[model samples]
Target: MNKKQILTGFLAVTIFAACQQGTANQDKAKDGKSISAGAKVPAAPDAAILTFEKESYDFGKIKQGEKVHYDFKFRNTGKTPLIISNATATCGCTIPEIPKAPVKPGDEGIIKVVFNSTGKMGIQDKVITVTSNANPEINEVHLKGEVTEP
Candidate 1:
């Protein structure tokens, strides 16, 4: 083959291989085939899957200076244990608590959020971000309500 023809063929093969590289690290499909890159795949059997029963919470109308709290329930639906590494809030008025222990598969847990309406008034929306080893990595929950004077 001519050098020019061989170079073109090599370049084409290289491009094709490069395009196929990212999919190798992707998860498998239900049919036990590897899913293509950028395609959604089911959670790995050995990976943790976090499932939230409620992603948002509404505290209704709460009086200023009152402390409101809710338990955001979740379950580990994957085959592996779920570990919540961190839980944070958007502001100091809100606090979130996550368990230190790993949540085994099929086990349930709660993310406790305490909202302090001390200086807050009117319509308020606060967010709590939970980081875990579960599929998708991070999850968000909300606390919303109107704060009125007592």
Candidate 2:
């Protein structure tokens, strides 16, 4: 073959090889794999962490001498089991009920709050303290609303 022809053949072969290499790299990237690029991945959070979906409750408007109840649902988003030690209301007029057992990861639980507005008038605010194994350890949930006079 002429020198010009040989050089043209070499260039075509090199281009083909480069194209094949690029296709292989794309396939590796498409395999749904990930790498940290020499960095360590963060450890999963503890399983026993109690995380509430909401931080507060609004009771809206209620008449005096009435009663209301609300349930706050939560999920165990950590990697360990979650345990709620206790739940306390801000005042005697408000009652809170917390889960009694540990909640496994991806599981759900509830916290129930009952408010008695017998003697309360106008707006009322209450809080429920939740003690758990969550990162912050202690969480305070709040309840607020207006109690209109009957």
Q: Return the top candidate by TM-score.
A: 1
Q: Which stretches of candidate 2 lie over 4 Å from their true place?
A: 1-47
Candidate 1's residue-wise lDDT over 2-71, tens digit each? 9999999999999989778765567777898877657766556589988999988888998999999899
> How would you encode candidate 2's per-residue C-alpha lDDT over 19-138 as one tens digit per residue?
887655532223356543443333345536667788888989999988989898898888888889889987899999888888888999999999999999988889899887776677
- The C-alpha RMSD of each candidate to the native structure, in angstroms, is 6.5, 14.6
lDDT of each: 0.90, 0.82
Evaluated at residue 64, the lDDT of candidate 1 is 95
User: Native-vs-model 1 lDDT?
Assistant: 0.90
For model 1, the run of ten residues with the poorest summed lDDT: 36-45
What TM-score goes with each of the models? Answer: 0.70, 0.67
